[model samples]
Target: MGSFTLDDVLAVRKRRDSWWTVFLVDPIACRLALLVANHTSITPNGLTRLSMVFGLTSAVCFAQELLIAGAVLFFVSFTVDCMDGKIARLKGTGTPFGLWLDYVGDRLRVLCCAFGIASALYARTGDVIYIVAGAGVVVLDLFRYINGPQLKRVRDTTRAVARENSGAECVFMDELLGASAPGSSTEEVRREFERAGDEDGRELVDLQRGFRAQFPWYDRVRMFLVAHRVRSHLISGIEFHAAVFVVGPLLGAVAWLWTSAVSGALLLAFESVLVYRAWLATREVARAVPVNEREKVLV
Candidate 1:
């Protein structure tokens, strides 16, 4: 029931570490790209467009039965998708417009591949599994959108806490993203820093620098990718590819008996992970305070 703000979104971005790192390695590479975007005045929407271009290519590759190339481009798209918002935050240029574009970009790219994969597999086997997979993809997208409001709340609270107490003493749980305060926004914090003396603002910057230094690059990358918001993307991608492409349809084509067994196993594994993420999202919603409390804090 808590009212929300931009900080909440950023927090979700940070919490991405909780799930994203396990499936992908060297996620820190994403930050390098973000850093470039930040310095260049490239809008988040531009980054989103770039991601879509690559994502479409990735999907096309998959459609043409270019699995390896598709997989490679898909990963590249993921990296860009992950980095764009961070770049926006670093440059203090985040906008609702850009954010909206980013969201649509992700959906377009993901759904494009989902539909392509389903069509391809359907053509090959007519087993209906690919269609089922495509339907699941649609459901997942709905889940994401329905869950987005709560995710925003969680992110807001985390950042508010970070600003109020200072992130230095904050120990981020594996659950949420940063050591953000429960209700603070980036704008509020930036204003606070600006109103203070030059020395004080410098100290705050130094604190931020120190915080970044404390975490090794690998750990940071792991955290960024696994952050709660983005976790589903990585997990879902792996599950779909591993199950539908590798285990189910592919295996079924090669060997029927083994295919059924592998499909069952993969389904069980993927569903379990999906359920866990659902629980995590529920827990985040539970922690959000009432709207009145959020308003008071903001006021």
Candidate 2:
């Protein structure tokens, strides 16, 4: 409707995104989204397609071993990639096709960029290790995308069942934790934390299971990360893409290789932790649900 402010743009962004996006890309994207939403007639799909063009051009730059240009363009491409979603949320002009395109386009761009990086590296030095590392990165990325959502679904289902078993009324993860809120800023998140209560049927901090019960050391870490607007997970797929596409291209080949390697390792390690926690939570849910049923029968 009226002119969109920076806050308006940010309000529609994901509650949690890659630290790379929160820090580097959001500054540009938030501003650009504001400008586009207010002044232009461009749809979210338009931005998606525009991002693809930049991404492919970046890939071409990388293929030619134009490291500096490639790095800059990739950053720009990623920033633009972030804008489409924010604009969609702000303007309410998102389409199913846009979502599908955004998802598939991201993977395609990454694969193209991966090919470009590997091709140039192999051409420059003829090292098989580069190709191997690139392949490993691609595989890791694919695994995260494929398994991460399913794991989240399982974890959420476990938590829901556990809460239902214990006769708890508050929803913890979705509201205040995962949902995109207005401003989606650290301040807004803190306000949500303050607003948590059972009296109003709102989100309450669940100390019953999952990481909260098992990992006491993580409480402060989670608080700190959430306050800083970073993901609670130490290293995720976002960091993995950021390392390979951004940090690597800027720092040189060796840094790129090690960064991508370390990023992938960290992502896997964090994912494994989540899986273990989910397993524990599921077992507890199984045991608790039966006990609750028995109590209900006795009553």
Candidate 3:
């Protein structure tokens, strides 16, 4: 624990984070990861693979109705998922391939866990409802996955237009929109955005700032629910496992099915909000760019 410092914790934390991770998970896991990073030679990709193993194991436990075991494994899986990136940063070994692996691994883990839980529940009770619930979760997860990159692209393209118009070295749209990497400087992001030359760029910046100011609580909650990274897509994984595998077994099969369905619904709602926000931001950026320039930049 002494090996990890406040700086180390800050190093791995995202510019925008969910409340759960900011307050709970990272406080514990990041330090643990720091210790592992200092003591071992494990690559970030290796840690990513380990997380997948834990996730798959948790899925199997859920399928067996081993609620306690499933919950424990699921938490471990998530903690390790956080650790891999921290470890990568510490080791200075992060790569595009590692990032790709982390994203794909998260998706696979969620899919496996959802299907496993549904299949197990159906086998025990002969209920088609569980299968439907699982399918719904999969679809919602898929949507979240697809929407994430699209949103990022829109944001990036819009920022590029702003940069071109302003001729500023640092546009900092990533920080303004909470898409920056962990440990990015907020002051720097703000300073750059405020320097935008054109009305559209400044308006978009002001709109984002005003939106945050107007709805502080909503902004706080949304940050906790969906942070900058692709793995945010799996935010529901812990809740889903806890509800269906842990709470469900204690309450009964009906409870499990209901919880699974609710988890899917919640994820769908979260992703919908994200998509809407992206649309608004994209429109703002498009309006700022000249129509001729928009066609050139966005494509």
Each prediction's RMSD to truth = 12.6, 5.0, 5.4
Better of 1 and 3 by lDDT: 3
lDDT per residue for candidate 3 within 1-299, as digits (tens), equals: 23556587566666545445566578788777867866777888998999999989988987886756776787778788888888777667888899999989888887887787778878888978888888887777777678778877876776776557644332333345466434445454455455554543434343243334445565444444434442343444445444544555455667766766676677667677666655555455454566666555443
Clashes per candidate, residues 3 or more apart or on different chains = 27, 1, 1
Each candidate structure's TM-score, on Cα atoms with residue i matched to residue i, is: 0.50, 0.83, 0.73
Whole-model lDDT values for every prediction: 0.51, 0.75, 0.65
**What tens-digit string does per-residue lDDT give for candidate 1 at 1-299?**
12323443344355434243333522553444445543465666777788789889877876775656666776677677666766666456678888788777777876776676666667777878667766676565556465556645644554454344432222123232333333434344444454563545422322122223344453344344433334433334344334433334343333422443454455446555444443443333323434434343232
Which candidate number maximizes lDDT? Answer: 2
Pick by TM-score: which candidate is best?
2
Q: In candidate 2, what residue range of length 10 has the lowest lDDT sum?
A: 290-299
lDDT (C-alpha) at residue 34 in model 3: 69
List pairs with backbone clashes in candidate 2: 11-183
Model 3 misplacement above 4 A: 1-6, 161-174, 177-252, 285-287, 290-299
